[model samples]
Target: EGDGAHGGFPADGVHRTSRLTAPPPVPPRSRLPRPRRGPLAIVVAVLLVLGVGTGVWYINSGQFTKVPPLLSKTEAQARDRLDEAGLDVGKVKHAYSDTVERGKVISTDPGVGDRIRKNDSVSLTVSDGPDTVKLPDVSGYRLDKARELLEDEGLEPGMVTKAFSGEVAKGFVISSKPGSGTTVRAGSAVALVVSKGSPVDVPDVTGDDPEDAKAELAEAGLKVRIADERVNSEYDSGQVARQTPDPGGRAAEGDTVTLTLSKGPRMIEVPDVVGDSVDDAKRKLEDAGFNVDEDRGLLGLFGDTVEKQSVDGGDTAPEGSTIKITIR
Candidate 1:
């Protein structure tokens, strides 16, 4: 009984002992309520990301652009193109250009496809076409002097045509095409009409002696000039072979007539082609320095064979003389 009383405890004591020995119940964790994510929060997050992206983009490429292609474009077109590219037109200048059209954009300051800042000015060099100059009066001037004047006026001396003029002296300019005071492009060819004073008939001096030719030309109010180099012609040696301005041609008074003396006709041996075809014979004769004349009679109209030749083979004939061949 005593042991029971000592060893065994009362129910209240047992309960107290159990409560002290065992760990106290952990108080239900008092967590704060999780905040609910709403549409407004999502929107704020998205806006922050967009703002960062925009800042990066603006810093890199937003303030500049490439120059637009403006070569060969008109002023209005270039302006429009620059406007579209967010650029301004700067100093506009005009210059002459042979290849570019007038009023067209020849080049840009920044050059096409070059990087430039937005809203910045782009200088343009517009074409004014070719340069122009006023033609000066060169009438009555000597041909050489007139050419000099034209060159000084930025013009090219073009074809010179001569005509008889009673007022203007020989070898002087009568007038110019496009006339005086006419505005013409620089480097333009200008034709001039030169005067050949009072016409005089040129006497035929060919085949005449040099002394006779000179005397005859002098009597006709013309001067005579003998060429240094003599040419081979049908006329005899030491005789006048050719005269230019030629026979019956008109010339100016006191004008010089040049005479070329002859060194006699050159003789060459003919080729043998009696049995050859007509075409072959002609080729051989022509190659031997002689002109070919085909004599195809009624019977030889369809003949191709050369049966006879006027100058036989191995015979000497004057160079450039005609060689007749009979075909059968």
Candidate 2:
């Protein structure tokens, strides 16, 4: 009725509705445009991919693989297996063991069932056979027989030396080098010293001149005697009388030869000097190489004249002897 005149009241038609008081036109409700999630969806998808990749890498790595056990296998066989599995073989050290064979594997570093990564190495202990054998006592045995025995024992016969031994018989072993009962590896050499026999003598020359005697004895492959005795004879005066390793006896070479010697002329007393001029007496006795003690002085019946001597006149004396004289 009102707007029918303006539409009813025209000019001041219904006081204008307050714009501030009217609720904003309800936003058009086109169903929220489907959420545009391009960046967010991409971020979530990347996270999922990373997680799956980590899981796959871990499974394919050897870190998660089980190592095989190989204690009973031969060294060669074990080495081949390790190589095939992308593992390496380390150095091999040898040791003596009663339960292991000469060249077989004694044991492994990580043992039978240890876990290890690829390209890792496993050390090995190999067998060098039982400890060395003790050499048997073989000295005094025949050389040929000893050699056979050594050969049977897997040892060698080294150099053989010939010697004359009193303790061991000829053609028999006297002793061995490297000694007996010493530990040695198979095929090791043993040196030998064999006895030839006891030595023998040549001859005896006890009455010959020293120089001549040495020559004669040497010529006969014998030795000489050296002896001392009293003698008046000129020929072979102080020479050997007896010998040993007697003339026909046996002895070693370089054996000592003994002998006796002759003691020269015995001494006698000097003659008396009474009534003889002291100077003349001195000259005579001194010319004979005698030692003289003089007693002549200026106080006697025959002043400075020799009156008495140690021994009477005409007494025998050694050619070169000492004499004492008393003068008045």
TM-score of each: 0.55, 0.31
Q: Each candidate's root-mean-square deviation in Å?
A: 12.9, 16.6
- Residues 1-328, model 2: lDDT tens digits: 5435565344655665555667678877687768787988998899899879888876676353334564546678778978887778888888886667777778887765676777888888778777676677678799899888888887888899887677777788888877888888776788889876566554665566567657766765455556444453222446544555566666555455665543433455455567888888887777655678876556654666788887666786654456788878
Off by over 4 Å in 2: 1-23, 33-67, 136-328
Q: Highest lDDT, which number?
A: 1
- Name model 1 segments beyond 4 Å from true: 1-60, 71-77, 97-104, 127-130, 205-209, 227-245, 258-328
CA lDDT, candidate 1, residue 250: 91
lDDT of 1 by residue, 120-201 (tens): 9999999999999999999999999999999998899999999998899889999999899999999999999999898999
What is the alpha-carbon lDDT for the whole of candidate 2?
0.70
